[model samples]
Target: MLNIPLMSNNISEEDKEVLADFIRTSDRFTNGPKVREFEEAWSQWLGVKHSLFVNSGASANYMTMAVLRELYGPGEVIVPPIAWSSDISSVFAAGFTPVFVDVDMSTLAMNEDEILSHITDRTRAVLLTHVLGLNGLSQRLLDELDRRGIPLIEDVCESHGTTMNGKKCGTFGLASNFSFYYAHHMSTIEGGVICTNNDRVYQMCRMFRSHGMVRELTDEDMKREYAEKYPDLRPEFLFAVPGYNMRGTELNAVLGLNQLKRLDGNNARRVENFKLYVKNLDPEKYFTDFRMDGQVNYAFIVLLRQASREKFERLTELLRSENVEFRRGTAGGGNLARQPFVRKRLPDFDPSTLKNTDFIHFYGLYTGNYPSLEKEKILELCKLLNRV
Candidate 1:
């Protein structure tokens, strides 16, 4: 562990071999066997009925929304402001309007109470995120949603190996999403998977993942004149709804499966590092661990007691000089929303829409955590941060 940087480079020889093996075989990029293998592994691991692979976490988000629009169109969905930029846009892309809500300060997840206040006759679902693996809000929010009979789609992208009260994190909601991004707990190089217990969602999502094509045709359609002419066509791949070309490649899935096999062990190591940070660092006056339920610690973070731009930059510079790399913990409204394109598209959008997210935008700072981070590196990070 050289002075801990944002994240250690994490592709191993084994992962490389897996990727190479997959590509050397099918290499067709689309409808490849490795994608199914990866999706199936995720489906079994998450205890969900179905899973679909996509190019990226953002692609998964947009696909989820696109599918949702087909079933439940033009409805209001509740989302926390403290989320990835793409998470917010998927709402608009799917023809639904996002009703941003404040988040609980501790969990940084959707504030159920605030959600209740925002819900109207138009409310259809809650796109909930288990922010930074803090899951205390999940059960309460789920209970509220149930009481109101509203549906929920979980964003478990940040909390893949996390759990609450012995139950897995992604299993609580109807449809849950996970990402195997380069910087995430697992590395697929670049890929995402959506999980669901519902048959309808599973059915719809398959078409959504593949450019809205009807992929699995029924016997009636296959027997018709269309079936005899096109042997290469799949009935299921047909477009049922307006969807994106969000299919995953075999290479990515092969890499992901290999990485997925080690997900638990990696999470455990990060937790060990998390405890080291807690035991060695002063918690009462400096930073708090956010008291998470089962954090994977993808990005070990803390909220500072004070917020000063100058101090923030100074600390960043100090860490940089020490050869430590870090990043401001992502706030809900990503740089995407603040970008010129989003601003113009949402010109009349109300500034009052996102409030709880503003706090995290400035106060949160995260040290990188990846499978490559060694014990020595974490210790070095602790020593450097404490020196300040």
Candidate 2:
């Protein structure tokens, strides 16, 4: 019964009406022209050459890892200790070892210094997750990756409009993933997309998304080559690689097309709300100087200036009394290295290796910051938070 919930659906009644109309009129409801149309629109928006819409953000991550595994066989992928389960799980699923790294407390993202130190000869790529819409990558990090010839994969599932150096976050990486879940900056109810400038990666994503069907390949010559290689099988049924059916539906695309129109404006409002939150929050009690230069604030991440178990307990109690909903530890289920799923694999794992991550795990929190959040409510929430 929280008055302020951690997330609110962005889809409006007008959006639902559009979806209803499409359902009633469209010739097909499965993956069809609408999906392709949405993909093109997203690519145009992200300034990427191609985009492939999929079932969920997790699927997008898995597909990207799958492509990388094909290009470079099993190796280590640098990942943040504080990220979504899928970010690490996808790496494992693709036969790559996940090398967990500490995060910078200010940005709640992988620490650039730690990432560089962890890069070994076995390092295949760096999987950077833009946690809670924060633009975590820096030019220095990108430069280092470029110098080392290591690919950068961006997981921008929580960051739809986040930018860095006048360019959008998804555009900087070799491949980028975005989520259009009901509660993200935009919504397709449940959809995800993978964008890339690399033609090979783009075609591989398409082939993997639809049961590895050669017909999904845009290159007619490649399709014909596959057909010739497998003359015993039906041309349309040719499976190139081991793939999964992670295709998104036309209904999801119908919603995405409309959502994209309002994404930037909504992100702007969230930024304004974050400014107000930072202005009103008591700096003595919380860490408000979060890195905001190229960040598109997703949730109001409240990191306590000092780690005190008692103060955290008091804050949570006050938040409950005021009915302010929040998620502890920000994003990804917090401290992936500490999670039982990861622990089972690396039984000797030491959580202390991620110093800043351990601090956030014990002290950080985040509440909802949607477009509809008002300055007055933000002020009120800050007052409640400070009272703790």
User: For model 1, how does the per-residue alpha-carbon lDDT over 1-388 read when each residue is reduced to its tens digit?
Assistant: 2466666666789888877776677638765677778778888887877888888888878878877777776888887667677787888888787777776666777677888888788997888887765663556767878888888888888787777776778787778888778877787778888888887787778767766666532235533434455557764444456767787776777788788888888888877777676566546434664655576666766555566677666666777787666667554433234545456666876544555455556656666766667777667676666655
User: How many residue pairs of model 1 clash at the backbone?
Assistant: 21
Candidate 2 per-residue lDDT over residues 78-162, each given as its tens digit:
9888888999889989999899889998788899999999999999999999988788999999999999999999999998888
Residue 221 alpha-carbon offset, candidate 2, angstroms? 2.5
- Candidate 1 root-mean-square deviation in Å: 3.8
Per-candidate alpha-carbon RMSD to the true structure: 3.8, 1.3
TM-score of each: 0.87, 0.97
> Candidate 2, overall lDDT?
0.90
lDDT scores in order:
0.71, 0.90
Which runs in model 2 stand beyond 4 Å of their true positions? none
Model 1 regions more than 4 Å off: 25-29, 217-238, 329-342, 345-356
